[model samples]
Target chain A: MQMTKQEYSKLVDKKSPPSKKLKNCIFAFLIGGAICTLGQLLMLLYEKAGLSETQVKMAVPVTLIFLACVATGFKVFDSIALIAGAGTLVPITGFANAVLSPAIEFKSEGHVMGIGAKMFSIAGPVLVFGLTAGVVYGLVLSIFRLF
Target chain B: MPQRTGHTLMLPSKPSVTGYAAVVGKKEGEGPLAQWFDKINEDTTVGESSWEKAESALVRDALALALDKSNNPPSAIDYLFAGDLLNQCTGTAFGLRDYNIPYVGMYGACSTMALTLAQAAIYVDSGAAQKCAAATSSHFCSAERQFRQPLEYGGQRPPTSQWTVTGAGAAIVENAGPGPYISAVTLGKMVDYGIKDANNMGAAMAPAAADTIKTYFEDTNTSPNDYDLILTGDLARIGSDLLYELLGRENINIRDKHNDCGLMIFDLKKQKVNAGASGCGCAATVLCSYVFEQLRQRSLRNILFCATGALMSTTTSQQGESIPSVAHLLNITI
Candidate 1:
């Protein structure tokens, strides 16, 4: 007889322990706070890099993507991300990190097709929208100024 | 014995049934949502009692509406597939139990409604069950207390933050029916877009919705124009725009019929639901109460309901990890 998804879910649950609720909560608090600290450090680095405001803005996201790619290669980002929750994603850097990490992790499937192409798997559309919206906004602002 | 005569046995064309449903929490006024409508009104924050009370009320209201339309009773329901965005699914569990129907509790973050409907349809089609009732619920106070903190906590929310609505919705699917039936379901493959901020769930979930919608069209050989409506769970405003952009890349235009239940549930100006609403209950309440009613009234026919979810754990969030999301789609045909 074929087992249903519900039945399969139940069977899987039987193998796992229901306990460890407290330990999980404690770990989440500590790890999540630590991740936020890393984000704060990155923000400081962006300010102290002695670059102009515009360059700092660009560098922040770029630096995050680089770090995330490295972390993805080392298989350490997912664990850290798990604890940081939304703290890691609030910044623009988090978005870059998320995009590049997946590409690096999936590189094992095939670098040219997988890592190189898929790295933008999630971030591709965001960049497209950002660029498109930016151009539209600029055009609208210019038109308004002419009036 | 002589050979059989002219009678040909015709097999029933594989029973195809699919449709969408939604339910809303507030009945015109009288909840936390009511305060959003009138600035002069008192209740700024939802109370603890309101959460518990609203969950039960919404469950009853949504279930009654669904049953009246489906013409099915509590007894006819073979299984009650239900869940909520509350702690341990308290609202759904406690509320559903009052009906005295046996149900299996499920949790898939915000994707509960679509997931439950998909599971129910599978059971009916496989002959494992004749009828099933799928339901999901959410309450603002309950969700805040469990997921974040108390309503009085008064923390500043990020721009991407979405308000949680207090509501519930239910759908009933049967083996035989003239009503719309569930046709097909596609479970999403979890995608982590590295969104560490919980505030902007729309960005995190939009990609999942695009991925699932693309896959569904591919797997079923159905084009975007084939359906009258393609609804996403909680894309709200920002995510809705993102979804449109993503689908455009595939040469699929969903601009006309595409809508987000999160954006539809409340009036932003009146209700002050910032960035609209999220959570499993957001789609559940809207689809059952509003969308299902319209469908039954013959306003809608074919609908593709895709519910999206952020599956990040508190542990992952604390670790500054990115958010992973999943989406599930149910094709409903009238």
Candidate 2:
């Protein structure tokens, strides 16, 4: 009862089981590698179909996004992600699922305010920071080139 | 007559549990305590279009079942204390809207079950009402969308993370009946041990649970051995251990007599619920069905049911404030 918040948190940390980081890493690596290989296969297939390099490059991600959206709709993505950990999450498909899920979830709240607004609830930070970083990097490169 | 003993109130009027019912979704129906529930809807949504509606439907079904079992019409109930793990307790409000009962909306998070029961018993014991009802619910989908993530969002849960139960429970309490009575209650103090992790709710809630249980025991001059069971709401694996450790620090051992509703409701290993089941429904369903059945059958004589809740919103967690938790205790006996 006399224990401070710091002391109690320490006790909680000591008592609570740690996440299986190494196991998760291994699973993530294997599953993520598989997804990348599949993407490569899709690219090779697109190239064989006589598509331009740029078209193949664009086609691969679109295909991956389509598949991810379907999986999200079918509600099987989370099951796979459970075992896959960051495997499913680090890919483009993960971003697609992240966007699509909230849209589907908030569909009941109506389209404009619910789906449109909340579609980016989870992935909004990534886009904002991603674009910001890109702009900053481009600015930094231009500044260096001016010399 | 109601008598105050320290922080606990002894309900000498014996607010009797006349009827109790639990309604659960598909996942809960597949769980270990499935047989105990009154209704097990194979559809998680309960044929409702949205997750929020499903949760409301669960609350409605649970209350209807309890009322039917009580052999009392809705008009007979004087007051209804109900809540759920939803924004503004909308699940309870919408669910019971058609019932036309005088409603007292509660917000105890997962601890809403015990909180409602305590309030209902107090109302009955104080002669404010001849009959009252306590009800609460939580939907996995609704809870996830509100508190965590969208249903299809792929994210791994931490080991200490709990699965919110998609269920509801209701109990009708009367001034007198063939008794499994509400004998006493110990209202908890808000206790925060500076636990900031939202995923690790057990850690956030354990201190309050330990505090309330200790207070109840001290107030009643009773020990862990005095009760057949010391039931905690949703302190799953980690929180339950922390509670035992906290109590043991004061040389009060409840490990032998303790059983958490979280642990009892789900088969952790097979269900893959990480720590255990949580949410208001976790405790509510287990208590209304299994515990109530045991009490009625005279299998368990006395129980100290303490339901703990992590009183933190997503906004509070994002604001870096620690989860302040409360646990409300009820002394239920046959």
**What are the root-mean-square deviations of the candidates from the true structure over C-alphas?**
19.6, 0.9
Per-residue CA lDDT of model 2 for B1-334, tens digit only, reads 7899999999998899999999999999998998999999998879999999999999999999999999999999999999998989999999999999999999999999999999999999999999999999999999999999999999999999999999999999999998799999999999998899999999999999989988988899999989999999999999999998888887799999999999998899999999998999999999999999999999999999999999999899899999999999999999
lDDT of 1: 0.66
- lDDT scores in order: 0.66, 0.94
Residue B218, model 2: lDDT of: 87
Per-residue accuracy of model 1 over B1-334 as CA lDDT, tens digit each: 1111121111122223333334444432443333322111123222224456556556665676666667666787788788876667777876677787778888878899988877777777767777888888776755764566323221235445677766666778777777666666787888665556677787678778888888888766678789889999998776777677667777777899898888876675576566678888788766665666556677888888999988876667878888888898877766
Show model 2 residue runs off by greater than 4 Å: none
Clashes of 1: 42
Q: lDDT of candidate 2? A: 0.94
Q: Give DockQ: model 1.
A: 0.02
Worst 10 residues of 2 chain B by lDDT: B242-251
TM-score, candidate number 1: 0.61
